[model samples]
Target: MTAFEATRAWAEAQDAADPLRAFRDEFHIPAHAGADTLYFCGNSLGLQPKGVRAAIEAELSDWAELAVEAHFRGRLPWMHYHEYVRDAMAEVVGARPHEVVAMNSLGANLHLMMVSFYRPTAERSAILMEAGAFPTDRYALESQVRFHGFDPSRDLIELQPDGPGGTLSMTAIERAIAEHGHRVALILLPGVQYRTGQVFDLEAIVRLGHAQGCVVGFDLAHAVGNLPLALHDAGPDFAVWCTYKYLNAGPGAVAGAFVHERHARADLPRFAGWWGHDKSTRFQMGPHFSPTPGADGWQLSNPPILALAPLRASLNVFTRSGMARLVEKSRRLTAYLDWLIRTRLDDTLDIVTPDDPTQRGAQLSIRVRAGRDAGRSLFEHLERHGVIGDWREPDVIRLSPVPLYNRYADCFGAVEAIEAWVR
Candidate 1:
């Protein structure tokens, strides 16, 4: 173990000095058995913000009172509902307002982006992705290749990581693109890996793919609000992310997409819908489809006002706290958690997440090595003791202490629980 001392007094002192500590009260932490659970699973599903209840209720009230007129007359009119989330979402992802849009769920948005960006020719007809990607991304990419009348096993190029549960090196990715870029029509990778919590070099990957003539995209489900992104500057063809995790929206919340301004023109072949049509001409019910400029042109239907309201509430919190401050606190919290695990629980566990703050997000994937049951037993032990980290399939316990709500004391209590259980 290292020389770091994570004592209770030290934890309390750190919590006292933390500028973001007051924001913790804005969330509703769940109770396990009777007491409040430590709740360290924000990477999976975030705790609900206190404002979410009123936001949902407001939409419900408006719907009840106005009926169809709610589209135009409600406090937040449904006709232009998605517009409210645009600037906030753009700020979160570091995109231009015209380049980002709140739209369908993550997977759906990925498929929709692929529809416009995954065009393949006989000479360039393959897709390159990380080996062992999130199952949904693998499935979507595979189905996309099949739809293009190509064989997944033959046409999908995969770059292997440095080692099992390790980071994918930029050199390996560049080498893969150099070898297969001619045949690769698209390059799709995650900004932050879901299982290992590795943050990829998004700007480098985009540059390499473009130099090799491949349309690049990112599935930022783990990266969006967790990391400060510059999607417009990095300039991927498109990117997609869900709002439920770091964004603190409820389950199945509305997802978002970024389409580079380069593709905002009418010439792009997209599946058009009435909602994506020009708003002024849309009410006229024209015979032909004329898309709204930029990312909004990708919309398929009107948004769910109730579902979007929670995001509006949550984004307000983000706007107030600011991403830069949140990231600074996130790095400190994860570093403390890492230090505690190394110094206190060294014999029983190993952290799979990257040590460098630049190479990962808030999640720490701890691999259990001892005890009655390898992973699940320890996970259950933590839960029974009022700690609420989640267990991944084979042997990983994922704990994400969100900067907005988690405290140094929470980290201390979590490590103390492990120490008690292990002893």
Candidate 2:
């Protein structure tokens, strides 16, 4: 029959059998007059988990009763609250407790990382990044380079692909390293290219950069919680990612930093704060800046407990679901979305995300061929009809089927709606 009929049939059957079907109820999906818009923008802001409100209230209650003593009196203890989430975040990023610390915002953490890792000398001062890297990343690197009195045009090396397509081949990246290894001091790439949803080979990039004597770091803004990232195992000198994306932390949640064990003991200098100082003697209010060993030394200030509560709630969801399960469901759900978009939506659509499941996350960036406003029009129309997705730049629309809350039915519903509009 029609695409609508086919999509409905597939959705019904898949929902009946999905193992994660119950999880849909765990989140309060946005609803309109007729239906719940298939929310696919979790790549940007995650759906608030039902437990988040309760978690925050607990912290609020403890503060009301215990005052400053809440630091020592609460069940979780505000005094050592940041540490509570460190181990869980370490697990999420595949880092050791000492290798990962949740702190600061994405750009701030990137700058802090550069202060220690991007120690460009007079001779080797170039910082390498991709041409279409996230605007935040580009700006951060630009500022860091200039902070060291280096010119952006001369000191920053952007390794742009030779073509219009999304990802740069590993060969081209290596070649850039070979040619500029002498001048290059650091290489930064997104774990998943935000605009294209193209996953980079972190281990491979790490190996090549270290071989060239250049320190490597990853901007996992679109990668962490979207896919499995063995940050410590990837062997990058440092990496930073925001939690709001796939981690499902609330808006402007805390970002995390990963520094490989090799640099744990190094005299590499960083812009330090009181929290980064030795926790054991922090109460002593000492004058010396003795940093805590490992990634804990990266913390600049005491994190806000209220901001972290949502992450703690969200991480519990992940703790139960586990990375392996999340990755498996991510592949299948994304594959189903791809299948529906291609198999149902006619020739009017072009998917920029890689077809290889292992080479991408749940996001599929679609470039509509139906003229200039086609993508925007479709996005607005979909929102009107209760099918949510995000539009980027001039023509691309990013639809991320977050496995934690997204379902097979949502995937089918998105394509069915798109098919109706294209008609």
Tens-place lDDT digits, model 2, residues 46-98: 99999999999999999999989988889789878888788888888888889
**What lDDT does the true structure give each of the candidates?**
0.90, 0.86
lDDT at position 177, candidate 1: 94
RMSD per candidate (Å) reads: 1.9, 2.3
TM-score of 1: 0.97
**Each model's total of backbone clashes:** 0, 1
Give the per-residue Cα lDDT of candidate 2 at 394: 68
- Return the TM-score for each candidate structure: 0.97, 0.96
Clashing pairs in 2: 37-386
